[model samples]
Target: MVLAGRLRVYLIALWIVGSGSNIVNAAGPVAETSTATIVENVSYQNITALPWREADHRFNYGPQSLQFGGLWLPESASADNPAPLVIFVHGGCWLSAYDIRHSYPLSTALADSGFAVWSIEYRRSGDPGGGWPGSLEDVIAGISHIRQLQDFSVDLERVVLTGHSAGGHLALLAAQHNDLPSLDAVVGLAAITDISEYALGDNGCQKAAAGFMGGSSLQAPAAYEQAQISVDKLPSTVSLLHGEQDSIVPLTQSDGFEHHRLPRAGHFDWLHPQTPAYRLLINRLEHYLPEHTP
Candidate 1:
């Protein structure tokens, strides 16, 4: 058992070092500097610099009039072809305070990279009928609503799902549902995979888990079970990217899954287009795309 445990730790170290090397190579001149220094030099202000699409269409997917919306950004689409689609979900601890607006930068960046982006805004804990099944339901509904975009130049077969934090958790969970369309790949950035473990911890987001689920795991075992993403149920080629220095969501949240760990990156680093973490994320996205795609 000790030997096995030691091997696991060794493998994790190798993975972290390998990921660091890739980040360094992708970061150019910054590769010569220390990881901490490179991270320190990254500008946080750039996240909000790019303006999102001025018009985002809102749709009511459910009966409560609790509408969900998608901000669509298509990279140039010709009459003969449609761009691939990427559905982005934002994270705000499953609360209304944190909406889809925070994801605008990342969505716009993806759009600029020659892809169509559908940034989703769903109901959250503070909203009436929000929480547990409601938030999850909204995500499923939003994705399903993609079928309604037939008129738009979107390649449905190449659709990918990407999310961060709470949204990451939702994206991962949504990928597991057989009812949803088969996804080409699912990318989670600092996602919360273990609902039970998260609710039991003392982290700042811990209490929000209870609020989102409506009770403790012990109090609502069935709900927690439904919300949790089992390792075996993950999409075949799921890519999880997380930061070693993230304080909001612990790295252990992605314990059982194969994930790439950035040396000194934080929770919000994934959202910034200028960070190495974002570069690694784009590489991962490109890896799953068809080779013929530009």
Candidate 2:
């Protein structure tokens, strides 16, 4: 665990310094408290301690080569006892370089907690027919593919959509587009809510944002308008969680939307089961779970 943690820290440091240069961009004029001290005071643990437990099944949603594929984490379930489901979308700055593999630990942990998990992979900005409407379309299709799992003992009415980073953006967008009446709630971990603001900023994901949307908000006004979240269109309650010390995607990105801010937490802290942020997430999710009459 210690070795893995060190490796993760090394990798993250390299990523920020190497590929993710805009990770430290200023949070614009957003009102933020003094949490900068926490950045230096905090000690990060390697959150990827758990090995990747292979999914029970893999399902393909569309005909396109990049259009399909989802990892299913099925906990014990019976016809009389159907497990609730969580459709998880991963974040990689909306790029094809990042995929759903990084989220295995979270998916495994959630499944261990008794909720069936579907960690999905979709076409990203680099792939052909990816980005903009294509990526968004894949998210919607992936969530809807839950219906094909009728053979599995799943309670569709207790479904939840949880996403991280770019995936969080897709999750919120999917909730607006998909036809899931049973979507009890949407949980976004360090989610990107405002695309136009993000594109205009100098964040690590700024360039990818433009790429994902097909161009600048001005160049692709229709795409930005279509993908941006409209609170009025949300089908379920939205719960956002962001780390106070997150420099990659600042806490301000979640501004305008109420979110649970974790002190001394960083971007990937929510994915670590041992972190307080993850516990907070589980607690929030408990309210939406089906009650048992013991």
Candidate 3:
């Protein structure tokens, strides 16, 4: 734990220096207080192609044209019923090669279970912080877009955020910054929460992760330190889900995070299922989200 903290400090310094050239372009603005930071007059659409015909939503925010679109599934059992909302984030180690499609099954399942779902895509580094703070910024921008759609069958207060793999990290960041009345809970599925552990992977995965992060802990300390994805800053009701046998992102990251901060955890739940991690993720989610209950 001490090593992690020390490493975090070192990484933070590197994040500041190595990422100095890009920090201004990363997160558009430092959130003074967690509020629904909106990026308006933007377009949201079905940008996915071919066999899947998935929707990839986009919106213009700050300097960059934020991509990694979204698929919004609205509640349809009745018109008057404003259903709960769940935002799904796709994980691809924050690389360009991976997009939101990987999470379609989970998104669709949640939506079919009666929740208004938003499966989101965001810019990735193809290596580390996954485009520095751009990935994080995109998350903020996407949720803000959804929040503005008041006429939609979305219940702001009951909003839930979930993501798998690298996306799990992004989802945690979103939930932490979501001080909005609509925000409810956050769920991470086999998340690479402890990014410093990228050294544990094979050469390819290691290169992909480190390259995305902009180098190793010794090289890009600032980015790692600036990375707010860890449990050190997680929200009150955060849930960390890990596959007991997960080889991609070891269950140890989740365990380490919980070990570091166990007291502040009021509503936090960490469960490794005898079943798939996804089932456990959904099960925990169902208990908190009313729409998913029955």
Which segments of model 1 are wrong by more than 4 Å?
A: 1-51, 55-60, 63-66, 291-294
**Ranking of candidates on lDDT, top first:** 2, 1, 3
| Cα lDDT for residue 121, candidate 1 | 77
Q: Against the true structure, what is every candidate's RMSD? A: 11.9, 8.3, 15.3
Clashing pairs in 1: none
The residue-by-residue lDDT of candidate 1 on 121-152, one tens digit each, is 78898998788898888888888888887777
Over 4 Å off, model 2? 1-49, 69-71
Which one is best on TM-score? 2
The digit string of per-residue lDDT tens for model 2 on 210-232 reads 98898999999998998888777
Tens-digit lDDT string for candidate 3 (25-83): 11112212111232211111111110121332333433444354455553363446776
Q: Please tell me which model should have the higher lDDT, number 1 or number 3.
A: 1
lDDT of each: 0.71, 0.72, 0.53
**Per model, how many backbone clashes are there?**
0, 1, 25
